[model samples]
Target chain A: MLKLIIENISKTFKDKQAVTGFSAELSEGVYALLGPNGAGKTTLMRMLADILKPTSGRILLDGKDISIMGDHYRDSLGYLPQEFGLYRNFTAVRFLSYFARLKGLDKQEATTRVDEVLKLVNLQQDRKRKLKTYSGGMKRRLGIALALLNDPKILIVDEPTAGLDPQERVRFRNLLSEIAGDRIVLLSTHIVSDIEYIAKEVLLMRQGTLIQRSTSEQLLDSVKDKVWKCTVEQHALPQLQKHYKVGNIQRVETGIEVRIVSDQQPLADAVNVTPTLEDVYLYFFNEEVIDGVQAGML
Target chain B: MYRQECYKIFSKKSIYLVFITIVLLLVYVHQLPTDMTMRESVFEELEETWGGPVTEEKVERARESMNAADAGEVSNHTFELRATDYVQFLVTGAAMQKQDQSERLTMLEAEMHDFDEGTYEHREAAIEHDMLQALDDVHGFYLIRSWREMFELIEPTTHVLLLSILIFLGLSPVFADEYTNRTTDLILATKHGKTKLVSAKLLASLSYIVIVFLSLQIINSFLNLLKFGGIAGWDAPIQGISSGLDSLSRLSYDGSPYNFDVWQFFLLTIALQLFASIAVGVIVLLLSFLTKNTMITFFVSSIIIATPALLQQLGTTDGFLGYLTDFSFLKLMQVSTLFTQFQAYNLFDYPVLYPYLLFILFAVVTGLLIMLTYRLFRNQQISH
Candidate 1:
């Protein structure tokens, strides 16, 4: 079954367009929403979670429009907002239990589910501690645990790994990859690396519109020859940066070395280099148009 | 859920501070010396300020000056004698003085000043009667003096502290904490987030209010009864009824007094205070939802509760606003006034009108507040 579908969705805040004529569909896998800050990735996810209503358009779950479903639609949906707010005075166990009850789990079921999710997030050891005493990563993990309380079929997490250290980030990614097998997980982030490994498909958003939607392999293939590397004199580096899209720069003992993305070779002794997800992100985001296509599409 | 909310209140340090403050106030009131001591002190001060008591030498000199009496002098003399002393003298003198001598003396006074009129006698008798009436008036003054002192000691400590603190503490945090912690998003996202959650908060606040109110009321009652000996029957002669009655007739009930059983008044005051406190609690909770800060909630509730009392203390000669203070909930909780034989006014006797009005107003305002909170939550954009 199609877990979620957002049809020609648009959201406006006052007079400003936040998300304009956005559309997407997801089913039983990890879907990454990639965007820069203020690109309306969070706004789109919020509409899908039913936390907000689109100014115009429909959000559906299994072919049923969720905007009209009210609380019944929300029962199977779990969301972790960009900033997760937990009561400082509540212990982790108490906090999760409260959310569980709110998710309509009965007492025994709430207790069991709280214990299960706490263990899943590796917070079982610290479950008795008050949230105020928790580290930032631990708090984030608790937020994820809360999102999983009802075993939701459609999980929406916004900037889920913004503050996690490397090890915790890898663990969180693994956790999501494990759970995404038979569920639809929409993960939104500005950090490219969080979704690079686990995401089944990536949706690139820029200026309130989805500019690109493709598999990770396809995104890299589109930018292959455009990326080139070269060794140059220290004085030649600044001019190279001004001319081409410089993806990375490093200083070598003999001189300055640089990576730049462009249609033609722009430097002497330049060699082709493999593009990264970060490079593709910048290419689409920085370029006004892709040849023969409208500026809105890639 | 309500039980958990109650636990939150009981465990809070602020609630303990309020509890301790109430207990200390009650203890302080309980330790006040008996009302007789207060009356005695007043009597001594009044005697010193307005020439000492009527002395025998003063009375004798006034009596000998007979019809040199400006008839005002006769009335003044009649106030100087003690009622007991004059009654004893009248009973004994009937046997000792000749009927003819007494008749001649009466006839001379009748000719001099129309003493043949009923309820009057010759110069000597009039002087004695004036002295007796004066004594009776002094006695009645002392009775009222004691009641007034007793009334003052209990009212402010028990009623004012209990009601205000309970309302303030119970409602101050209702919406402020949710906003401060940014948990309104999570709450509003739930199935019963809008209706059940708001209702739970209101119910929790009222539960705390009742607990605090009852605790203070029970403590105040126990302490008050411990300090003042139990006395019943509070209906007292209304003030301004003494002008037409004769001295002997007025003296019959003058020194006799009654008190509203303190327990009954205490319970009634508690009921009034509870209603008023809950009404204020609801209003303050609504304000908390709007303001979303505890400090603002505290200040706003304080002004709402204290404005009337402050106006009352400024006194009634200030006009209509002053008169309006009589209907204040703060003023109505003063049950001790019901024990006084004479009140400055009948303001406290009327059943509390404002508390009922406020109760309805609170309900309407809280209903509106819940609706607003629900709407805000439902449409809330979760911010990082």
Candidate 2:
């Protein structure tokens, strides 16, 4: 059983604190770190990947400090950064083979694994083609394939599905679900739906701080009865958004269909609805995710 | 791993571009010595009176013949001065008509150990001192008859020097490539990324340097031999060649007899240049780690590498600046100057050979650069 314990981690870059006092103990399941852009999701994932050391606190694997553990700890760690890149001139196969060598796989093993990963990413036909010619979705899939090269116990990926198409996103989510198995997969994304089905636990973050951590169901239950779809006149939509956390706003034939998460109903005819993870995300971080960067300073 | 790193370094089209550029430059600039053709022209011009090679009898006869000629014809009494014994040529020939030959020779010999206060005179004296020291035990001097052999050996070095510069260009991107491609995150995160992988890159760069250096030397050597058809003065002291009006200089040999033949001196020069190339490779590799931009590293590296040559061209190679520059860098690559001049840094009243001192200094600098590269890269935090 692999265990990773992050104790009071924080990162300060110049005058900005990108990650602040994040602590977690994870083992054997997919944990979705949900946050919007610039919410320190990337920074936290980088810390877990051991690519960026926290300014304070210790990250340990199996009770030993990852910092002191170094490469030995890294051997069981796989990371796919948000802005992943491959050598432009390197063919897909060569790119994977080169990385395999760096990961300390032997010649025959690296070659075999390169072929396997190429097939796993569904890029076998394009394995011999230069990476510069690969499409966005293909590159993202290749990045995922690279992350799985060493079959690590801990997998950390940040904003992985941002460039992928909708179909590819669903496929990728399924792939992540299958690979998560008995390993800790910390999947970070701002898109709530990406992890709604697969994430065993959801960690909600705003302004570099963890606001909440619970199962998806528990998170949705917290916002139960809070989500109310109310039919209102088009003119009343703006006022409704101003007073409550608006999850979705749409215009209809007669008026507008508005979904808002709030404690009290704004309309008498509004019906209570079950919250999706999106509604939960909107409930906890509706105002904070958008205004968090400037809000704390104000 | 090293092979892969080398592929990253050498397989680029830019490397081949640089190689082709250097090859073209070598073809244009490299040529055998011209001293022989010059001597033959002089011999043809003076064949009526001096129809034979310059000997002691020919010298006496030419002096007598000049004395009997009319004053107007005295100006026409000139002949090519291609004598290997430069001092002896000065004394016997009419090149120095104002000063007595015997007194000038005595003054030059005296200046070997003693110096003058006047700036111009001191420099001239120093030059002469070094020249004489170069030819100290050199005997049986002769005029330049055929320079084909002499030039064949020296011409190829242009390619060597140019190839060294090309090496800097080829290696400027070792670290910057990862940054430009945005692969540093992946590469540095791997298990062996920071340690063995870095080691592999360094080894690949060094091995490429060696291969380029040795290949250039071999190509030049072979082409030179093929073109000139002989190594005539392979074992002859350089003091035996009269270079017309070309200034004579000599290489220092670390207290060994100043009696090295041309072959030994050429070999030493090649060795010194190779050592300098190693230092240059390390320097380029160091610059590669300082930033994640290849252009910046290449630009700064060009400045650093060319500083020595620029200082020489700017005439900063004389007193204080010269003392340091002479024992530092590209001076070792100047085979002609080292072969003809006995230049040295008089350190602590001991004339230590510049090449010996230079290679030692390069080794230390390269070592420090390597350490600095490791420290910088190992502790690096990617900001972009």
Candidate 3:
């Protein structure tokens, strides 16, 4: 059976469309929800989580509508909000225990669960320390611990590593990879690299619409020959940005080195380069596609 | 649930300060002398009675001789005749015997008249006797005390505070906090985080309120008894029905009238003060929910609670405006006025109408505020 299905979901705020006609189905493994700022990625994820009711469309988990399932659906779902809040005074253990109770575990069971999750997040030593005393990375780990307290079948984490240090981010990425095998793990992030290693599939969103859904390999393949690098004068950078979708620009000792996506080489010295997931992301999110390359390829 | 909330309140430093301050204030009040003279000009009276030069050796000797004769150790005629002869001898020199005698007689007569028939002396004696009786009555109350009676005394104030704090703090983060903290996206993304968690929070907050309130009331009552002695009488002396005397005369044993028994009035005053405090708490909670900031909630609640007293004070002399004071929750805190009898021109004019009317009005307003708060919470959008 499909673990989760979202059908034509849309959400609007005041006069602005946040998420529109978004649909997806997942059975298992890691799915990366990649988008730029204000791309309705978070909105679509929220609707599937049942935290937000969609203006139109239905979300079904195991063939049961989540809106009707209510708390029962939530019982099997683990969620980490983008800006997760904590009761600053609470110790990490105490905080996890509270969430465990809310997730319907009794005292003895909650204690065992909290201890297990604290170990899973590698926060066993810091469990007795208050959240206010924790570093940003530590707090993020605690948020993960709380989300995993119920042993949820489907885990949803939004910008899970936004504030983590390089070492901690790598550790978190590895941890997510280890857990993604048996259950569906939906990861939403603006950072392409957070998901590049673990995500089996990538879903791109732009301006409240699903721009693309494909394997990480397929997304990279689509942008393979389209991305090109060229060295240009400092004064010519702005002109290049206007003419083409500039993915990256680095100021060298001599002038500026630029990475741009185009179907054909636009400059004499330009050379085709291997494309990363970021190249595909930049192509869809940034305006202006090359003449021969279809925008749908994004 | 209640135990958990109690633990939270007990953990807070602010609640500890409130408890300590109230206990200290109660103890300080209790230490005040119960036999205090109420007259404003007590010092002047003392000055007028004792401001004179000391008597000389001759006058002292004469007074001593007369005192001895009055005790019947010697013949009064012999002592009086000798005293007169000695006074006459002194009168020829520096002594003012006649003036001294007149002053002595006036002082004695005044002392006798005051002790025999004055209201202060009578009331003082009555209070001394009543206190002893009250100690006995305390034991009786303990034997027959019921949960219903205790609840009746406590529930109103407790409910007010509970409802007030819950409504205020519960609404604090509903919209304003989320917008300020920029956590709307994260919260909305969780499976049922927006809907389930918000509801859980509201439940937790309200539970905290009920626990805090009940604790405060229980602590207040215990402390009140410890400081002021135990409850023995449910009906205040002022509330008693008496016949064959005017309202003014019933308040006095002698011709001079006073407010009421200070101890009884003090107890009633504390109860009323608590009521007002709870009312202020409730109003503040409503404002907090509406404004969604601690600062706005504090300021708005203060203004709403204080406005009644301000209007009463400013408009008291304006006749029609005086009636407005009767409706104020602030006036309820002035327990002294509630126990005092107001004068009227005729039998048709009754003074009990004001407090009775005000009490009902406050109760109704409190109910309405709670209803409004519940509606606000229920209708609020769970998800951003």
Report the number of the highest-lDDT candidate: 2
Give the true-structure RMSD of model 1.
13.2
lDDT tens readout by residue for model 3, A1-298: 4478888888988899999899888878999998877888777767767767788999999989988887788778888878766656668877676567667677899899988988887899999997779998888888888778888888988898888888878888898889878788999987889888899899888788888999999999998999999999988888887778888888888788999987778788999999998888878877623432555655
Q: Report DockQ per prediction, comma-separated.
A: 0.28, 0.61, 0.17
The CAPRI classification for model 2 reads as medium
Model 2 lDDT per residue over B1-384, tens place = 888898888878877776767655544544524333333334334444443223556566555544545344434323344322232343244223212323545787676447654444456555545544454434333322323223322333443357556776778899888888888888778888877877898899888888877766666656555444444445655444443432111222222324566666666666766666777777777778776688888888777656777787788788777766665545544534554433455555555555556666667877988888877776676545
- The weakest ten consecutive residues by lDDT in model 1 chain A span A287-296
Error of 1 at B254 (Å): 15
RMSD list, candidates in order: 13.2, 6.1, 14.6
Q: Residue by residue across B1-384, what tens digits does model 1's lDDT show?
A: 555555555666877887787689768856755322222233334333222223344344434443334444434333232222232222222222223233544555455375433332333344333323333112211112122223322445345656666677767777787778777666655655555666667788888888876776567556644543332223222221121111111112222122223234334445655665666676777778878898899898777667777776666426667655644545544533332331223223332333334445445755675577666545655443
Q: Write the per-residue lDDT of candidate 2 for residues A1-298, one digit (tens) a residue.
A: 8888989999999999998999988989999998766788888887787778899989989999988988888788888998978887888888888889888889999988888877877889998898889988889989988998887789998888888889878888998899888799999887889999999999888788888999999988888989999789977877887778887888888788889888998789999987898888788777774466467778
Off by over 4 Å in 1: A286-298, B34-162, B229-268, B308-384
Fnat, 2 decimals, each candidate:
0.30, 0.71, 0.23
Interface RMSD of 1: 2.3
